[model samples]
Target: MTLPAVLRSAAYPYRANSLNLFRLILAAAVLFAHSWYIAGRGTGPSLQGENLGGWAVAGFFVLSGFLITRSRLRSTPGDYLLHRVARIYPAFVVVLVVTAAVFAPIALLVETGSLQGYLTTPVTPLQYMWGNLPLEIQHYNIGATLQSVPYPGAWNGSLWTLFYEFLCYLVVWVLGFLAVVRRSPVVVGALFLVSVAVYAALGVAQRGGLDESFALFARLLPFFLGGSAVFYLVERWGTNLIFGVASLAAAVGLIAAIPHWGGQVAAPCLAYGLLSLSAVIPQPGWIAKNDISYGFYIYAWPVQQLTVLFGGAQWGMIVYLAITVVVTAAFAWLSWVLVERPVMLAIRERRAKGSTRSEQLPGDIQPAAGT
Candidate 1:
């Protein structure tokens, strides 16, 4: 199909687009973005006070909004919830368990030179495993792990966003249940407006400085809603070359002119740019086959921290990033093949069987002819 034709379709997100590659790149960007901080280099480069990691994460949220909203619309609540759980939990739980039980203890022993202390610590295996699972509002730092690193004592910096990502999933579920998502342009437009208002208020409040939390929800929700709006109205406001170029220009102009609220102001345009770029960009077949992005995202920070622990943070970002990327990508590949893909396939098979059973006619059994 032509690029414009692809963009105009509501089904485009589910089709063969470069979105998978985009996600992989974004995941890599997050790893790269964290290289400096985790290596204790500096705060790192940012746009409008948000780092590359932050921007990449925001892009993730936008893409999630577009795709997940479409998913919710196509599914019943039970199916939707099941899909969400299947997508998120299997790999996540395994990682948490492995990290808590094996890696944390090893790190603690290595750093503190006391297996006894690691075993006896209050924040050891049980606490770390259980607390981090179910919800991420628990101890982010395991006891004495990576404490000697220049960044000092943070185990998984990438995990904090998972909490919010899950929260966004819940938000989409609730909106879908409420029939708000059905309203499409109207509801999504209003949501975008509300997000903008909240963002503006927070920006004014934090004019002197920018806290990651201060305008986070305000900033992210709009991008997400923008994506939703695009999906809902793609047939009417379809992506074309002219539209894509214009939107990109608009985003650039807005950001350059109004750095404080430019991202929010240009969110719709940004969403359009992302969607168009993904649609138009040519990618290799393998880009769509093995999706290791999620694994990379969840695994990169700890690997980077380990790199700092072994190599020392004073090593340039080049060495740290090189080591971290290689290790993390290996782990990510294993995660996709071993854990994620298998679990997802199992869930889909179960759902298909359940659907088949449900479709059977009741009381359709035949009696014996002789009787």
Candidate 2:
């Protein structure tokens, strides 16, 4: 197909595109945004009236909703659930185990003079693992992990979002299983509207009553749903330069007009902006080849903390960010090659052995797909 024709085709099969690189950049953006506070600096600058980290995270959800919803359409509930579990849990479990068995003990011993004392603490390794379960686990400090650092106590501040990411995945799965997404595109669209209403309500409550995390989730849910809506929009209207331009324009307008309400208007605009950019830009070959965004996201905070511990938080933000990028990227590459990629391959291979051909649907982002 011609370039314009591909742009307008809902089934253009963009698995060949640069989503992996795009997501890696988003992950790096989060790391960059977090450097300020982690390095004992105050809040950093915002971009186009939104916090950079917040914007990067919302972009993640938008991309996830777009991709995962697409995956759901071509999967049985069993396969869909399995794919999610394989994708999220293995690396997560590995990180948790390492944190508990390795990092936590070291940190606790640093805090107290005794490993025995660390063991005697109430937060056992088992509790540490168990507490971060089902979803929304607050098992952050296993007896003072990273307690000596600038951003002390929180081993991984980035973790809280994974819970929400999984929650959004489950929402998509449940909605998909119920045919709310597949059989009734209108229902999915309506849910987007409902999400906006919830976001608005939470925005009001955040000023007076709601917890900040709760408010954040409420604010982000609309973006996830908005991504799903975009999938249907592509299916119905197909992608086009005109629509892409309009989406970008609308996003700019929203950022200017509704700078409050925790990005209620900005979410859909972000989704469209992401999609439009992908549509218009050519993804680099090397970036599209390997998916390291997940590893980067999960590992960046801890690595940054470690940097602060060793190098001192007095380092300038640029130096901190520069050091962090090099270290975190190395760790992320290792994670992809050693943990995430291998586990996913084993799962896929095991499943493949049972069947004659690959069971995954077209355009279903595999576990290796960035974010």
Candidate 3:
């Protein structure tokens, strides 16, 4: 069944509420982790727990896969793309522009000794603006030194993940189209696996060793695949006790194994497990009503960057947690009001208009369709 029909199937709408809560929690986890990074706590048990950020990002991937695939199944490809673009790009571009024009200058002034360095030194400006781009497509550092200017020198690191995310959307769109046309899940799955393998190999090669490569692998493909697995299970079996238990098991395994992987290599696995767990668990009252994962994820890095610039000190865990909550909540509100809500409403309106137009068209003009 196509994703739209599956959603309209009335078999599992409530089940997704649990996943929404999971997303909000995961967003908090990511904020905590990034806060630790900002505080320069790069090692030890405190930071180890913070590794859950990877799990949160992975959960987002899974959510995206499930939701996007479902939508594609229901709508025409053009409509699907339009909806997805509207939902993601407006907020993303706004954030990107703000980070570049406003935050980048401020960060550069703080990091370098003088504002003159921002204009004069090529490296400094490049690094500062690199974080401003939506996807972080340009690598900031080359070899032992930063190739671009390092504005917000130690900030906005989480923006790196968006690159992988945009790529995932494209991959899903192409694979989904192929699946719809070919009527073969096996073919789509096989293509996805091959892409993952190739990217994993490239990550290994670029890093020059297994240990380094593993970190890249953890960041990209595994989390996405984990999400794909969730879509497959939910679509094929429906929401049931058995599949829920298996998802729980997978989540536990991933969490337990993440610490062993070391460095960033453990991140994706942690994300996969947490996301799986969310799928199975019941929604908490707070998050069920106001899920803010997307807000949390996008806002945390910039907030931390600003905090660090203001000389926020590294203290105990409690202090860090307090600061993180304050910053995350503030950004979450902004994201909801300025970014998420407006864009979502616009997309829905456009989709509704398109649907009305299609319905108004003559029945004889419609093409024969099947799924």
Candidate 4:
């Protein structure tokens, strides 16, 4: 089966193309934010503004929750796990290996003054490779020494978000399973709220109230619940203009408040509301039809880091930015073609075979009669 056929048969109601495009645009926003930080532009006045990239990460969490929940609603637990693993881990492993074996060495060589110094340093090539191994399982900052030595001091700084994303996936899977067994949204919501509170408290105690851990958990849990709520609302009330307008308003209010309200509280709220609105609104654009946002999100950081390593910090920020864009676009294209497409095809084939086998089975098959 082709991609189009799989999409057409998908049980979810929203348009994939539109969501994908939104994700890509958010990813670009993230890249720009990171670039600004790297260039020493600070969070002062600029065309793109400061720290908008953090908002983009917020958007990603909400989007992930919305889409992943949508898929879970239509799949068995086994199938859902299969799809999620295929979507995430393969690219993750590939990037981890490349960053460890290829990028880390090149980055070290570029930044260090002497080969002897590089070798003699405690954080040697072997140490760097070992550190990247923890990254495969989401333990970052293990062997990092300096924040800027190799650009993020680790293979990929952006990967920190993936750990949270995977955690969100596990949360959704468990909640979804419980919901299916008990058929109670209230129970699921309660459980989610408690988890968020505990996560928030732990984050605050561990890193003080200033750290991202509390903020991230606080922000993301609501967004995930918001997506689940959207699904519930749509199912119960049906998609209509009134609810659509409310969701749109909520989204707009959230976005407009992001810069002022601060990322700690405002960003996740905005992302959740916007994604909720997006689920209801009709996608109507060429860009929406061919969205590649997730692809852009996961690939842009490493590409930028690599550029910084090779091109030198003295190189113009604009030049580095342009190079990052070009390289990231190429990577995004490849990810869509090689990683996402094949996995999706395999999913479709498996589903089709399962359906066929079930159809072939008879209710009254008399195995004892041996006909």
Q: lDDT-based ranking, best first? A: 2, 1, 4, 3
Off by over 4 Å in 4: 1-17, 44-50, 112-152, 179-184, 192-219, 238-291, 312-319, 355-371
Error of 2 at 340 (Å): 1.4
Q: Write the per-residue lDDT of candidate 4 for residues 1-371, one digit (tens) a residue.
A: 45443122122245332455556667787777777655555552232243567656756665565556656666677776776666666666666655555665565555564344544455554555555444333433223323463335544556666655666667777766665523545754565466555444654555654565655555556555544544554445434334445655655565456543233233234434454445455555744533345566667766777676565445776777788887887886776667765766686678787842211111001000000
Residue 13 lDDT, candidate 3, scale 0-100:
42
- TM-scores for all candidates: the values are 0.85, 0.86, 0.70, 0.71
User: Candidate 2: where is the Cα deviation over 4 Å?
Assistant: 1-11, 47-50, 105-116, 122-126, 203-214, 354-371
1-371 per-residue lDDT for model 2 (tens digits): 45655345443345555567678888988888888888878767785556678778877888787778877786667767777887777777777777778767766565665677565566667777788765466777676456667678776777777777777778888898674557667887788888888776765777777797777677677878888877877656555656667776777677666645545556666676677677657766766656778888878877788778766456677787888899888888877788877877786777777643324532253332222
TM-score leaderboard ranking: 2, 1, 4, 3
Candidate RMSDs in Å, in order, are: 9.2, 3.7, 8.6, 10.3
The superposed Cα distance between candidate 4 and the true structure at residue 111, in angstroms, equals: 3.9
Colliding pairs, model 2: none
Against the unseen true structure, what C-alpha lDDT does each candidate score? 0.69, 0.71, 0.52, 0.54
